[model samples]
Target: MEKVIEMKGITKVFPGTIANEDVDFDLLKGETHVLLGENGAGKTTLMNILYGLYQPEKGEVYVNGQLAKITNPNDAIKLGIGMVHQHFMLVNNFTVAENIVLGREPKKGLKIDINKAIKDVEEISKKYGFSIDPKAVIENISVGQQQKVEILKALYRGAQILILDEPTAVLTPQEIDELAVIIENLKKEGKSVILITHKLKEVMKMSNRVTIIRRGKVTGIVKTSETNIDQLAELMVGRKVNLVVDKEQAKLGKEILRVENLVAKDSRGLNVVDGVDITVNAGEIVGIAGVDGNGQSEFIEAITGLRKPESGKVVLSGKDIYGKSTREIIDSGLGHIPEDRHKRGLILKYSLFENGILGLQHKKPFSKGIVMDYKAIRKHCKKLIEEFDVRTPSDEVNASALSGGNQQKFIAAREISKDPELLIASQPTRGVDVGAIEYIHKRLVQERDNGKAVLLVSLELDEIMALSDRIAVMYDGKVVDILDRKDATEQKLGILMAGGSLSEAKREVKDVE
Candidate 1:
């Protein structure tokens, strides 16, 4: 196979970190190559060097068999290379066509040619088998659609080599399926692709070859046809990873949290969570399974005191807490692992030790009436960093400096350390690597075994099935059905997630059987 892109001896260094070390990578002309690694494992750094976002201290880039001198994104684009970042770079207020052609606009008599831009977008979208509205505003579109616009933007710039960074991080199962189809179409069009991800399933399903990176170095490269999940995981983490979550049957106890007749509105003042009723008992995990945007976020926010419920009774340890402040709720034994760790969980600018005792700043040993015990705080945070296996150079660094997995580990450590009676973990392992997921899963189960009530809200059905004792399917802001772990299957949950009745889901499962 002909090589479309190659990086030889790529070495990139930051102020205190060697992002990539003597890395060699190559992409075949029409193949989907996966760059597999854990968070902070140098996958993104290598791709950034290739995309001209950063220059390697020691390396040579060969584009289509020729040495390339690419120093900027424009240079890379001119060389027929494009990259779609994990976060979309589209202007939200502009239409899809406008965003796609923002830099290289077609012109007509000293004015931007809007009609031609739309036509060009439509043509490229159709060629790629994508169904996107060229005139639709970016803000009004779904995250999945915004991703499509990013891809269309790259195609519009005549890119033959595409790099997708963590493309499926925020997508639903159906959206992931759609993206798989889109990648297939791109492959059929003979465009080479580089998929950067920590997901083993995606690598197995989408790529022809896989390159594993760990601790800033290449560990192994193998054909996807020959490698199994276990081998790939071991290579990526440098250890044997227990992919399956292990836990014994739950020993149910008294009710820890009860939500009755809950009704909540979104930011636009529309009812998103409507009449949700559920209970989490001590020593059990009650998983909320649903497609994204089904009022799950609102329901969690309402119960956690992040948002007020219009009409509901949120009782924690037999006390009403619906209208209580977040701090009060926390003081009342509610530990929340918010979905967006950066926004709700931690203050990015603060040092790790400061964030470690964030909510507890006003409490016992760490502080005494406005006098914080800095020595004690540092000792406590250092223990947490070690206990949770947070891979950071020092606890004095800003929280923003840590990788996503490390930050999540820190939050998990802090929340679990509080020993709250009721722990509400939302998307706890969303972007974490397999090793971190293993650790987090084990911790959640350990909490459950220790008689803590856990309310888990996740979009990953497999995760829900693996961790929950009782699974509650939410649809259209309602608890459509709740099933025991033994009674649930992916087929049944899939039907219920799409708004089907419990009986209908059962029938579908029966038909499948």
Candidate 2:
């Protein structure tokens, strides 16, 4: 195999951290090579150096055996290197064609040829089996379609080497499989890919070779054929990692939360959550399983008081709390680990100590007659940092200073510390690494064992299956079926999630246990 890209002794440093230190990485021609690491482990830093978004303080970069100086994205693009960021950088209001052809627009004399741009986008999308509509607005499309547009944008720029940073982080399982096909097609067309992700399963399924990095340095490089998820996880985290979530059977208790005829609307004023009824009992995890945008977010927001329900009874511990304010709801025994950690879980600009007391800022110990007890707040923050293994330099630092996984851990720690009667954890481990996922799962199960009701909402079916005592399948804003853990399989859940009738799903699978 020919080495198409190589970085030797690459070192990058920030004010307070060595982002990458003496990292040597290489990519072979026409191969899917994964750069695997935990959050803030310098995986993105190294890739940024390669993409010309950041320059290495020291080291050499070689493209096709020739020394190259890529000081900007334009330079990298000209050198046949294109990168699709984790967050899709498309203008939401723009059409897919417009986004793809923004920088290099095809023009007929003086004006941009819109039709030609659309045609070009369509051609590339078809060639790569992306199935994207060129004329569709980015905001109106599914997250998966928007991702394909990002890929199309890179491909349209004549890229021979593509870097996808956490591409599957926001995708559904079906979309993930579709992306695998897209990658295979790209490889068949002689294009190389550098995949930056922490997902061990995807790395195993998609990569030809895997390079494991931990704490700013390469730990091991191995052929995918010879490596397993366990080995890769140990390499990434520098310890023996527990892949399976260990938990005993649930000991059900009285209902902690009950939602009857829950109706909620999206920003557009159209009902997204339509008459959904659900309940979570103490000492059990009732996981809501569905594809994203299938009313899960609205349903959670409705119950959490982030959004008011149109018509529903949200009973918390037998008390109807639907119309209560968010703070009142929290005070009335609810802990929410919101779906968007940055937006709802923590204030990015606030110090970790301040963020630690976010939902509980009005409570005792931390609050005394409207004057905050900074001493107590700091004490609590430090405790959470130690307890949750939040890897931060200090409590005085801003929440944004921490890594994604650390930030998530901090939020979970703060929420769990509240010891609320009903805990609503929405997409708790969405973008976190496997190690953090393990910790978060254990914490959720611990809460259950400690006689707390946990309502888990996640798009990852496997996660729901592993963690839930019972699975509630939601489709088109309704609970299609709630099955016991013993009766729930991925296949059955898939059918229910796709709006299959409960009877049809029941007929497809034999009862277990």
Candidate 3:
């Protein structure tokens, strides 16, 4: 193997923190190398340096065995290096071809050549085994398709070395498999790839070599054929980790939440959540399993009062909370961990102490007659951080200062501290590392054992299967089937999630038998 990218003695520092220190990383030609680490462990910082987004404090970069002085993205692109961010940078209303060739468009004499742009995009899509419509609008496409467009953008720019950051964070299971095929195709074309992700399963399945980074330095670099998930996890977290969820059987109690004939609409005025009926008991976790955009978001919104239901019954703790305000709903014994932590969970600009008491700002101990007790608030925030293991310097810093995983842990700590009777945790561990995932899972189970009703909504089937006492499969805004944990399998859940009825799923199994 030939060395394509090499960084020696790389050290990047922020104002008060060392993001990366003396990190040595290398990638070989035509091989997929994985950069695995916990959030804020300097994985993205290191890649940013390579992509010329950030200049390193000290280090040397070599491309094709020649020293390179890349200072910006344009310089990196000129060197055949392209990066696709975790968040897709695409214009929603523009056509795929337009977005791909926005800056560097093919022109004819004096005017933009739109036809040539589309033709070039189409040709590149075909070369990479991608099935993308260059003329389709970005907003109208699925998330998976949008991701392909991001990759195509990089490929169209003549990227020989591609860096993908958390590529599967928002994709469905089927889309993940499809992406695997695409990666194989890219490898067949003899392109080197650097994958930055926290998914151990995907790391093992896709990469030829794994480089583990802990804190700000490389801990170990091993061949994928030799390392298991456990070894990789331990290397990243600096300790032995429990990858499996451990919990005893639930002891069911009275119903804590009940939703009957729940109907809700999306921003487009269409009934996305149509007539959902379900119940969560006091001492159990009832997980809703479905692909994203299958009415799950709307369903959760309808119950949480984030969006008003068109028509439905949302009863919480024997009281109908149907038309209540979000605050009233929260006061009515409901603790909600929203899916989008950035959008709904925390105020990025506010101090951690302030975000800690977000919804409860006007209530007792935190506030006295409209005047907040800063002392109490700081104490509460400190306790949440210490109890939840949210790694941070101080409560005085803004919420944005923490990494995604630490922010998530802060939110979970605040919500669980409320001690609500019915806790609605939506995508609780979506982008968290394995160690954080383990801690979060244990907390959810502890809540169940403490006689609280937990309503878990997640797209991760492994999570649904591992954490739920009963699994409820949702399809097109309806509860297709609710199965006991002992009776549910990934195959059966997949069948139901794809809009097949419970009877149809059973019949298919019988046919196979």
Candidate 4:
């Protein structure tokens, strides 16, 4: 096989971190090559050097067996290399065709040929079996469709080599399956792909060859057929990793949270969450399973007091806490791990110690009579760092300085340590590595065992099946059905997620209550 990309002796460094050190990576033609690593392990840094977003301090890049100097993204595109970032960079207000043909568009004399651009985009999408409306606005489409637009944008740019970073991070399971097929189609067209992700299951399902990197150096490169999940996990983390989540059966207790006839509107002033009811008991985990944008966010926000419910009784330990101030709700025994960590969970610019006591800043030990207590705050932050295994050099460092997993761990430690009666963890392990996922899962289960109510909301059905004592399926802003752990399967969940009737979904599960 011909080598499409060869990065030799790559070394990239930041002010306080050695991102990549003497990393050698290569991708063969017409193959899906995976780059596996822990968060901040220099996987993205290495790929940025290849994509010309960042220049390595020392390295040599070869494209199609020839030396290449790619100092900018334009240079990379000219070399038939296109990258789809983890966060889609499309302008939300622009049409799909317009976004795809932004820099390189067909011209008709003095003006851009809009029709030509749309036709070109439609043709590429059709060729790859992508179901995307070329004229639809980016924000108007579903997240899965938006992802397809990103892929279409890459294909329209005449790319022979594509780099996808964490492509399945925000996608539903069905969308992930579709993306796998799309990658296969791209492979059939003889395009080389380099996938950078920490998901071992995806690596096994998609890659032809797998490269494991740990702390900025390549650990091992092996054929996908020869490596199992255990081997890949060990190689990536530099230790033995237990993949399965170990926990005992739940011992149910009294109800900690109850919601009745909850209603909420989305940003567009539409009723996204309508007539929903849920209950979570002490010593139990109630997981909300649904596709993204199915009113899960609004439901969580209403419960946490981030958004007020239109009409509902949000009873926290027998107290109606609906429409209460966020602080009031928190003081009423609620701990929230919000869906958007950067936006909702942490102040990125603040130090770790500052963010550690964010919601608790007004309370005792952290603040005394409105005077900030730095000594006590620092002590608590240091304890959380050690107890939660947050990998950071010092508590003075900004929260943004840490990796995604570490930031999440910090937030989890902060919320869990407060020992609230009810804990709401939303997408707790999204975009984290397998090791971090394991740690977070154990903590959630621990909270349950300690007689705290845990409300888990996630798009990953497997996660729901593994963690939830009772599973609530949501569709179109309503709780379609609630099932016991034994009655919930991926197939039945998928049917309910797609808005199928409860009876139809229950028919698929033999022992349903």
In the range 236-323, model 3's lDDT, one tens digit per residue, is: 9999999989999899999999999999988789889989999999999999999887989889888988898899899999988997
Candidate 2 has an lDDT of 0.92
lDDT of 4 by residue, 1-513 (tens): 999999999999877779899999999999999999987788888988999999999989999999999999889999999999876899999999999999888999989999999899888988999988889999888888888888888888889999999898888888999999999999999999999899888999999998898888999999999989999999988889987778899999999999999999987888999999999999999999999989999899998888978998899998889999999899999999987888899999999999999889999988899799999999999999999888776899999888776788889899999999999999998778888888899999999999999999998887899899999999999999999998778878888899997688667665654
Per-residue lDDT of 128 in model 1: 90
What TM-score would every model get versus the actual structure? 0.96, 0.96, 0.96, 0.95
How many steric clashes between backbone atoms does each model show? 0, 0, 0, 0
After superposition, candidate 2 runs with Cα above 4 Å error: 510-513
Higher-lDDT candidate among 1 and 4? Answer: 1
In angstroms, give how far residue 392 of model 2 lies from its true place: 2.2
Q: Write the per-residue lDDT of candidate 1 for residues 74-121, one digit (tens) a residue.
A: 999999999999767889899999999998999998999999999999
lDDT of 2 by residue, 1-513 (tens): 899999999999876788899999999999999999988898888988999999989999999999999999999999999999876799999999999999899999999999999989878988998887889999989888898998989999999999999899888899999999999999999999999999999999999999999989999999999989999999999999998999998999999998999899987888899999888999999999998889998899888888988997889997879988999899889999998888888899999999999988888999999799999999999999999888777899999878777788999999999999999999999778999999999999999999999999998888999999999988898998999999888888999999998787777765542
Q: Model 3: how far is 151 from its true place, Å?
A: 1.2
Q: Residue 276 of model 3: what lDDT?
A: 93
Model 3 residue 21 lDDT score: 93
